[model samples]
Target: MKQHPLLLLVTLTCIPAWSLQADAVNGGIALIPLPDSSIAPEVWYHGQRVLVTGHDGHWQAAVGIPLSQSAGDDYLNITGSSNKIPFTISHRDYPEQHIFLNNTHQVNPSPDELSRIHGELKQELDDFAVFDGTVDPHALNLTKLPVKSNQVLSAFGLKRFFNGEPRAPHSGLDLKAAEGEPVTAPASGRVLMTRQLFFNGNTIMLDEGQGLISMYCHLSQISVHEGQLIQAGDLLGYVGHTGRATGPHLHWSVSLNGVRVDPRLLLTPALNASLLPH
Candidate 1:
């Protein structure tokens, strides 16, 4: 087929538009091409410091993107500099049934009671909201799974739809375990908060140095308390559906600085201990 002059001109014009569209679907995975000396030595996401690596004249960061981050386009604002890079997130559709709870327990609280419970829960979250301060990214301590069971009832970063209305994304990984199952700490940290909330029931929040913390919710009992320093393998509580739930399970979550990151990211193959909050 003979290429017409008009057709060739139009194709050239469309090339830039096509490239822009391609970038939109590719997510925000890219190397920072700026020289390491030109870039600020640190970057953070949701208050948790990111681990940036420089190699071969390129800068890379192992950014811990939060599960609560909404899907679609996102951006990372380089502090102290005007560098802003765009990133895209492909939509992740989670089935609606996973988050719903069925009424079964006679001990279940009424609507008014549940509201009171929520109020208490809010207070606990407020206590864990302290993430300010410069941090060394590699200072955070990380470890392997404390338990051998891998059966997950719900995953982190799930977009929740409650009763056909969109709700906040689930912030933790839910593991189904028998009532009264042992709940162990994933790493060494200080107990920041322990309380019975409306949604989380018996909750334990552990601060692993710096601003990094881990939370365990819906427990049958809390064994730790505020200002208490705990070591790895310490019993924080017993797994049970204390808060709102369809069944007994443990909700395991990690908050870097203050941003909730993937719990699995803190674990290693041997389940050995590592990572000290900077």
Candidate 2:
């Protein structure tokens, strides 16, 4: 089936005259212009820190609208600023996907397994809450692809059903990586957390400056340790079918300000123009 790009309409009203840059689509980013390069204002959206970047004496904050966000008015708050930025969010429909699982245990875990899963989920949430404000804000640019393949086995934001039972939406991009294939960091960042889980398996979460973070999951091996600093294209791990996966592949996810956006959005032309230098 052909994949369609999800669309969202955002309207900004009663805000400062700072130019509204970047697309305002669902799973997309919106760049809110800042007062000056020196003013690193604290911006918040959906109770999470907004990723900020500065260039050429101008500063802008990037806010990622989640795919599940309904069409309506949304607001961003800048601490100590009197004016509130109001923007509209539009609707985007994702396609449904069905997968049959041979492992019935994964589909319906035992009581002990459920307890373990809950603990792992809490750890992941804590990791995602981290935001390192020390790194260069301009380092938010994702310079490389995590895996070597251009083929995508599955797109992001698809509603998935396992063995005729509906499950959570697909939250990340699935790349076509062979078993034991090397996975690398797409951007420079510090390792935040690494752990194996029932759903994600061996996972490495990297904090790429500000509120930009990336995760590589279902790995056969992890080469980096927690708190380790990694450069772009640095080896993170090897791909595998370690978790609930049916086959060997890489599940890569990108989070902005704690909101899970499409990983491919970072590769889009619109983001490259605004986030990357010419």
Candidate 3:
């Protein structure tokens, strides 16, 4: 489950260049080779802006394919370019996971809770959509692991049946941590949100420009405030089972262009290989 080498990021993490020959799989990233341009061309997919940067001798777009993407033809639209960048996505069948929650309210929220849930979901989506065209794309490096742990990521994209009922697929990587353990920022970014979400509990969302965002959820405490700027390794919160969680674990999510992809794809090669594919 190693990922294709990233032009800007792979050198920092020693992952072999060929292990990820084809990254265009479901719930993965599609590194679409782009045309040579003095300035990176703006790319878009389904209305969301994409991260286009220098790759080798040319430019490319590292698209975050949504888990719901079909295994078929997909294209990226280069702004003002008539020709589209066509890439084929391969299908990937992620395994299922079942969890029994004693909290009935978590398994099924009340009508009032549902209303608040919808609002929180919308706020998060809006935060994810901010592209931050002002920031330098290359300066935004995603090379650090938020939590230091010997255990690799084993649960991501799990189609969970919570309390015998189907729920949304797990959208983030879970790192087993104890209560009060420190959680830090993976990259330099401005904190977009620090709120208690319905299912996320105490959450902190960071925007790293070019629509590359990170969210740390299910915390016992939030150490940062909204609009605060933080660098790599800066503390954002502490681990806790604050939201709809079973235990004290950091639910770390990395969303590119507003779509949730496998977080390990952006990790160092050694760390990436240790983490199993979703």
Candidate 4:
């Protein structure tokens, strides 16, 4: 087919952008260059931090990743820029492990009850995804954990299966803690969502502004509420196996620009330094 001159030019122009759609940066890692004020959030690899910088007329942000977050296909859909760009993320795979939830707790419901429980859990998670909040990402400084309890029981990005049926990849870190354990905010953020979920039990969602959000699940009780602005080390709630848990623990997750990334990546020195009081 004979292509028109304009069509050929347009096709050539899109080649580079199209190629980028399949590119993957590590989790928490992004090379954001906002030449214009219109670029939206981008997705980096699933387990690495990405660095982004604004140059010339562009603004950028980079993210470095830690050993959390499951690897898989991810995308960055940007908007409101002079140019709209969507980046593709290719996640590298890490080793996988499984723990037998084989021993059922006496509190476990019967099979019919479990089915009902699953439905309720889905509803709660959906609520977090559709939460309404002001899109802000810079009003607060990301901070370090106030205490030193950083042991990880379940790392992010591991593919999960329930009862031999493949399930969604795990999106958060599961830290072992005793019931009634204190949970604190790692940084300053606004409480955007707080609810009792079927699977999460007591839950909290914090908005760190600019489309960054954090989720804390399976709490025994929630201490914050929607629209409440909280500071670093602020009390969020107590740990428990509230939702669809096999035991008592805390499931912590982080989402950047709406993409679920490994929360541990944000704890690194580079990201942490950027969050300190200047």
Candidate 5:
């Protein structure tokens, strides 16, 4: 039997059983409980402060496991505590994809383009690392779909090869849409960046606070500005093939603690709205 994709928006007063809500595989989010405290406990992993939410002494660190992480036991450093909290993750294999492009530059860029890409990469890293501890992480609602089209172009974590050369694994979910289709914000967040680059083209990065953020790429138009506060279901931009894309599509990426994870794992479908195709 197939199960309907449901959105479980958790509240701080009552925490859900950690295990059953989300998978703990690589490129996934793990909600690990912390020691009881009167307030939220600050958790750190790999020198980055992880997102800690919930209240009334039942705090949990929402750790974003890197896609390259191995399936093994890991621990987090909680401030003011000498003991480390432990957690385990299982392994999951993703399939590979080989894409053919007629333009060789799309697969391999020139020296000048490479230099531009290097600068862009640095800016992208800085954008992803934006973590505002002020906003309560729980206040961010991320269950909404960024695109209404049910046509998903690609899934997350697919080992991808372009023009017979291997590239980075797909870090975002790509959705097929019309050239002028409207893209919406899935949560309430402040815009961190809006830029046009070599690969992503017109891009918008949103900070959902507490080290959680999202990115919309390959956009034809950008409606919001940097530091703009946007509500859920608000217009973000129009979808198009602005970057190194084969066709009109939207690339949606979700990150936690500077790590990109599977966006599907964070989204919940509405009534009769199908989840990403298997």
Candidate 6:
């Protein structure tokens, strides 16, 4: 019998024996438990496909909570499931950061520059919306470091002011690296897109399969092209002070199901601990 996707989801989600286990905080990852191990179910949240993985006779969907998401009740719908899995997102207070840019144009562009900026923004959105399912789902290990730098200059979710004017929050992690330092892929994946933007400079976006994507920006050089298959530690580019940056550094971002989350969340515990203050 060909069961409807939603019907199958309902059956799997209704397994009362298993419960969803995941942190419910801004920039957190949600692990939605599934009832059946035999069937790989499709999970969706806000119209984007969620990443699913199996363990110990059960399956779970890994959903990234965007820092911009408002606090309070939220839900993810399993395609074949009759009911939505309820989740809560708690509030998080990120520190504020102010930066003075020598290039005032980056903060406020001219009319001609504004048009170019808008075009780049549209292209970025299109790249992020891609969900590649053919790549091996198990290949994603977000904890791997793309560059050998423990010096974190800018943390994620930081509210920023540019030259006394409020700007968008910092969406990625900035690592202190010298210009011409090589940046590698943190995970095995295929290059989905690459762009040189008004703000990001040279950038490479890797599709890690199942809605997991990683981006490297502000590079002095880009070695990989779009549609290239790359493994972990493969050279994608070199760090630089390109685009709107203040100095030479690598800005790395990770997205799950189209939601940008803290790149620190993907770092291994040991690495994370070492980076913390004493």
What is the model-wide C-alpha lDDT for candidate 6? 0.80
lDDT score of model 4? 0.58
The full ranking of all candidates by TM-score, starting with the best, is 5, 3, 6, 2, 4, 1
Q: Give the better candidate number (5 or 6) by lDDT.
A: 5
Give Cα distance to truth, residue 145, candidate 3, Å: 1.7
What is the clash count for each candidate, in the order shown?
Answer: 11, 1, 0, 46, 0, 9
Best by TM-score: 5
lDDT tens digits by residue: candidate 5, 93-114: 8999888988788789999999
The CA-based lDDT of model 1 is what? Answer: 0.58
Write candidate 4's Cα lDDT for 80-120 as tens digits. Answer: 32443344445567445444555343245678867877786
Candidates in order have lDDT scores of 0.58, 0.78, 0.80, 0.58, 0.81, 0.80
Write candidate 3's Cα lDDT for 85-182 as tens digits.
Answer: 89999988888988899989889999999999999999888988889877644323345567776354446678889988999998988986789999
Among all windows of ten consecutive residues in candidate 1, which has the lowest summed lDDT? 16-25
Model 6 alpha-carbon miss at residue 144, Å:
3.9
Clash pairs, candidate 5, are: none
1-278: candidate 6 lDDT, tens digit per residue: 89998786656544432232246678777776766745777888888988876655477777888778889998888877888888778888889999999899999999999999999988877777778776644333345577887788898888999999998888888988889999998888899887788999989999988888888999999998988999888999899988999999889988888888776666655656666421
| TM-score of every candidate | 0.64, 0.85, 0.89, 0.64, 0.89, 0.88
Error of 3 at 167 (Å): 0.6
Tens digits of per-residue lDDT, candidate 1, 144-164, equal: 454446667776666776545
- lDDT, candidate 1, residue 19? 11
User: Which window of ten consecutive residues has the lowest lDDT sum in model 2?
Assistant: 6-15
